[model samples]
Target: MALTVHSRFHPIHTDLAVVTLTGDVDISTAARLRDDLAALLGDGARHLVLDLGDVSFMDSSGLSVLAGVFPLLRESGALALAAVNPRIREVLRTTGLTRLFPIYTSVDTAITVLRAGDDAPS
Candidate 1:
């Protein structure tokens, strides 16, 4: 199945883009996913939350796509994952990537927590 990627800003935090992915993310779809994700950051997303509840499978290419964005994001912002399944979680664990990202149980929770950090008095 083709990967379906969609992005929307949080209602309370316009700079945070909540990107939702459905279907498989493999070699065939990794490039397209990369472009879509880059577009989100380029369009001024200071923070990103990826909702992966509906994405059933992901391969190394997909992991590569996600890993590729980390540096650019750290220079200006952050990235989080939501609703990751066991299979993908294992992939991340095995690759030692789980330490690099904060995974939440839901998109809403991720938004709330990330937003709270920004809202803190500096």
Candidate 2:
């Protein structure tokens, strides 16, 4: 089955952008995610919260896109992942990426942290 990724962007506060993702993020959909995120950053988004609650899967390609964007986001802003499923969380943990990205239980919590300027890696 072909997996389709869907992204929805919402502006929170003044500088935070929330991108909600649904469906699997594999080779076929990683590019779309990257483009969507790049567009948000291009639009002057200084803080980003990726709500991955509906994302059922994410492959190495997806992880690559995220890893590549981390430094870019940090150069002028912050990025956080919210509601990541257990499978995806394990991937991050196993790859030691858990240290690079802040993971939250919900979008609201992520937004709150970013808004408070406490998004620095812990």
Candidate 3:
């Protein structure tokens, strides 16, 4: 399945960029994902909320892209994941990446946390 990425500034919290992704994130799509993420950061998004509820699968390449952008977000902003599917969650847990991201149950919750500056890495 082809990956689709939708990016926009949070409606209420302009400082936060919300990216909603669907389909599989693997070798074929990791680069695009990385580019999109980098673009958001470069566009001056200080906080990000990734909504992964529609994403069905993710592989190592996808994880790598996420990890690569993590430090950038940490240094200049905040990053959070919302509505992650089970498959992706398992991958993150197995790879011990769960500690690097703040995972929330919903996009609204993530937006709130990020807007309040509560999702910063500890």
What would the per-residue lDDT of candidate 2 be over residues 1-122, giving only the tens digit for each residue?
A: 24444444453375678888878888998888889888878877777888889889889999998898899977767889999999899999999889989999999998887777744565
Q: How close is every model to the real structure, measured as TM-score?
A: 0.95, 0.87, 0.92
Please say which candidate is ahead in TM-score: 1 or 2.
1
Q: Candidate 1 lDDT, tens digit per residue, 7-95?
A: 99877678999999999999999999999999988888999999999999999999998899888788667889999999899899999
Stretch of 10 with least lDDT, candidate 3 = 113-122
Task: Output the TM-score of candidate 1.
Answer: 0.95
Tell me the whole-model lDDT of each prediction, alpha carbons only: 0.91, 0.82, 0.88
* lDDT for model 2: 0.82
Instruction: Please give the range of 10 consecutive residues that has the lowest summed lDDT in model 1.
Output: 69-78
Question: Which residue pairs of candidate 2 clash?
Answer: none
lDDT leaderboard ranking? 1, 3, 2
- Candidate 3, residues 1-122, lDDT tens digits: the string is 99999999977667789999999999999999999999998888888888999999999999998889888878768888999978789889999988998899999998887766654556
Which lDDT value does model 2 have at 104?
A: 100
